[model samples]
Target: MSYPISPPTVSFSSIIFTTTAYLLKYQLTRQYSNARMALAPSAPAHRVVDVISYLAAHPTVELSVSDIARGTGLNRTTCQSILLSLEPRGWVQRRSDLRYALGAGMIPLGEAALAGLQVVDELRAELDTLVAAVGLEALASVVSGDEIVVVAHARLAGVLSQTVRLGQTIPFVPPFGIAHLLHAPDGTIDAWLDRARVKFEPDERRAYRESIRFAEDRGYVVVLDVEARRRFEQAVSELADRPASHAARRRRDELVARLHREERSFGPWTGSESAEVSQISAAVYGHDGHPVAAIGVHAQPHQIDPSRISEHATSVLEAADRVTARIHGRNPAMSARRPTRHV
Candidate 1:
């Protein structure tokens, strides 16, 4: 009985502390295990979402399950399962050739999302008015990541009017995208150029620098003729098709250099059959004084007399100013200052 009493040296407080610690540890372990199981289900769902996003980004292209898997870096079987599940829900449609494209079901969702954008709502009337005044297509576009996305557009009444679809993503290249590059910061411009697989030669670099500087000073950039623009774009598309090899890049650079030289010599709006179309665009600035979007007017040589290009450009600048003022909630009077005309 005396020996048993000595065991009281291990106090009741110590016993309680040890038992409490053990229970706390057990509870934490159980919570962790449950959390891991709950999260495990999300992994597959995330992979499916990734597949949908990849397909969405390339809405025009029809891709097979293997292509989607390769693009999203998901297992083939996983992509197949996801696509199969989505097809039933009308989120995707599989073609007779087993290619998949975004289905009609996505339209309602897209419309709801676009309806929430204040800029789109505010610019709708302006775009419509500009189209009517210019007698040509008018487009509002913003830089989205590395591409330019057309958010809104108004088409003119003529058969020659350019047709642009909403939400169309265009490459950040000349002619179509020069307005954005003109207003972008120098570092951003450099990074965008670097993304092109083709390297620029010294002469090509100088020409681009001068062109951008000219646009920056004038607040707009002009595409002289449609022919030159089309040829250059065609060459660029060809370069994109080839593998990125040193020889291929060299060839691309050569083609670009030749185009630049030709453009310089051809002059702007010479009334040649090939040089019929001209385009002018002005940047729309946000509150930060950085350009967030561009509004542009396109005209045939007949529509805009070469002598009246300055006047047409002024109209575009005014439209762009209205957009800028609306976006930034600034006084419309602030944009009334006459912009310098550059032909």
Candidate 2:
């Protein structure tokens, strides 16, 4: 009845078969591509952890998602996923502006981590006392990765260093750099110095050697200028013979303790550009004679001189020792190794 049915140009069965085959092939290709992507080498987990740790340590920093991902060597998608997961766990916070930072979850963990780090805690009071006594800035710092972190700082009620604050990272350079070198083996120190490009050559090495030698002779090392170690030796020698009155020493220690309480009373440092001022830092060595942390006393260029610093060096050294003892506990063998001179 209908017009003669044209011989089916393509049979329904054939059409169905072709469509099915195409779909199957498409799906297979997609799955294969996905598998390859999955198998590809990805960013190392440790790198990711490093990024997270930095963010946790510096929470108030306004960092973009890409910035965070770049630090971790992760892609945006992956970093986003991590941020999302962390948000729920309260491990991190994403502001309305989408910057990520440490969250409330870190409070307990940070407390716990810090609880085990008694060196910082024990020295806090001493730092307070020192600031009060000297009417100068004082800092307690620890080595964190390749940098030093200021954990606590004390300033005379009116004297403040516009440069740094607690949790601020300080570059390891001369004076401060000496502490790192003191503990490192010659080869290690040499390599680091080279990498840091401090302009120290063979002669410079000899000078550094002489300075540290002098520092060892004295109870602490003091550098007068940026990257200068020559005065270190002089400072050490002065500290040895300089006589500090008992009353002065007591006053210094008490001030250091007060500074510690006041600085920490506010909470962890939240501001960016937490700058550190010019100061003298004494490296506190472990009972094993390893440099553990550094305690610094700061003042404006016009306010203090090398001679005054030498006078107070003894009290500062004692405070450093007390904190070190608490953190490392009693080790007769290790105790014997504590350097009479600060590194």
- Compared with the true structure, what per-residue lDDT tens digits does model 1 show for residues 177-214? 66776556788667655654456776765667677766
Residue-pair clashes per candidate: 0, 19
Q: lDDT per model, in order?
A: 0.57, 0.49
User: Model 1 segments beyond 4 Å from truth?
Assistant: 1-83, 92-104, 112-117, 158-163, 174-176, 226-228, 231-277, 300-305, 329-343
- After superposing all C-alphas onto the true structure, candidate 1 shows an RMSD in angstroms of 22.0
Displacement of the residue 106 alpha carbon in candidate 2, Å: 1.3
Worst lDDT window (10 residues) for model 2?
Answer: 263-272
lDDT tens digits, residue span 236-337, model 2: 222211212234334433432332223222111121122222445566666666677778675643434444554556656666666667777332222322
Measured against the true structure, the TM-scores of the candidates, in listed sequence, are: 0.58, 0.54
Cα error of candidate 2 at position 60, Å: 6.0
